[model samples]
Target: MKDTGLVAMTEFLRHPSMVGSAFPATARMVRHMLAPIDWDNVRTAVEYGPGSGRFTFAMLARMRPDARLLAIETGAEFVEKLRASSDDPRLIVAHGSAEDVGRHLTENSLGYADVILSGLPFSTLKQEDAETIMRVTGSALAPSGIFAAYQMRTAVLSLINRQFVDVRQGYEWWNIPPCHLYWASKLRGEGSYEDQIGGSASA
Candidate 1:
């Protein structure tokens, strides 16, 4: 078996835009990102850009036996590695962009996801692509579902707020570059996001 760390670093060096990070997320970072989720009742979850399946495996460990996790990866190497690494029946690895997440869910016979987690670098993505993803992600969740993402920067915060009415932010300082967490839910609203949540985020 290949060292997952080496594989992740290799991919990140080769495709920095797609892979985002040169290292896997730290245990504390993962816990901080997923701590608020109620894994027992989440029947369906979607993960974006699961480069090394680190968070994927963590979610699988906490999720119910019958729950399903749809992993959408743009990197071919990551997709292949994830499929090769997991024998768990609950994992469904899809090689594609997260823009097609809605279709992926429908194709998999899932109505809506209870948990949508992303590790994609939205700051590196095209402006239109990032906007589309945040918009679709909000619509793809179940009413009470949570959408969480962690980034080295807070550039995606405004984009997330544009889609989700209620958004919460957190920070984990132990990671390599440090990690900024955002947990967003509820749908669109008409107020100013900056006015509702006043703060500055920098990393």
Candidate 2:
């Protein structure tokens, strides 16, 4: 079996749009991105663009036995790799776009996730697509749930701020090329998904 790093690099070279990053996140980066999560209370977690399952493995190690994880990936190869990497019944690897995270959650019979972690390169994505993902992520999170991601650029910071009520930033220089980690939390009174969509449509 190829190592996770090789697999991730190959996938990125094959599909930059889907893979997002040329290198898998280092252990340090993963730690920083997951630092704010209270695993004991995190019943549901959704990971977007889980390239090589680096963070996924870490999350599973700390999550409660009853907790469930939905790993959503656009790359077929990555999805297959993820499925093969873990046999934990608590994990559900979905092959799809992150923009439709709400549908993925509903299909899995899951309510809003307690935490949403993303490895998708929002800076590399189109502005509209990035905004759509941020909106869907905000609406799909449970009240006060966290949405965390490590990005290579600051372009998506504004989008996150627009959708989430509170936003915090951190840096990890140990990773290759380094990155900025964004920790954003949904507001407690954001209302239901329908309400959010209706408000957006009206605006």
Best by lDDT: 1
Cα RMSD (angstroms) for every candidate in the order listed: 5.0, 7.9
Give the residue spans of candidate 1 off by over 4 A.
Answer: 187-203
Give the whole-model CA lDDT for all candidates, comma-separated. Answer: 0.84, 0.82
lDDT of 2 at 174: 81
For candidate 2, write residues 55-138 as lDDT tens digits.
Answer: 899899979999999999988878888899899989999999999999999999989999999888888888889989999998
Model 2 weakest lDDT span, ten residues long: 194-203
> Could you tell me which residue pairs clash in candidate 1?
none
Report how far residue 197 has shifted in candidate 2, in Å.
31
Cα shift from native, residue 124, model 2 (Å): 1.0
The 10-residue segment with the lowest total lDDT in model 1: 194-203
The Cα error of candidate 1 at residue 73, in Å, is: 0.4
Q: Tens-digit lDDT track for model 1 on 23-135?
A: 99888777767766768889999999999988999999999989999999988878889999989999999999899999999999988999899999988888999999988
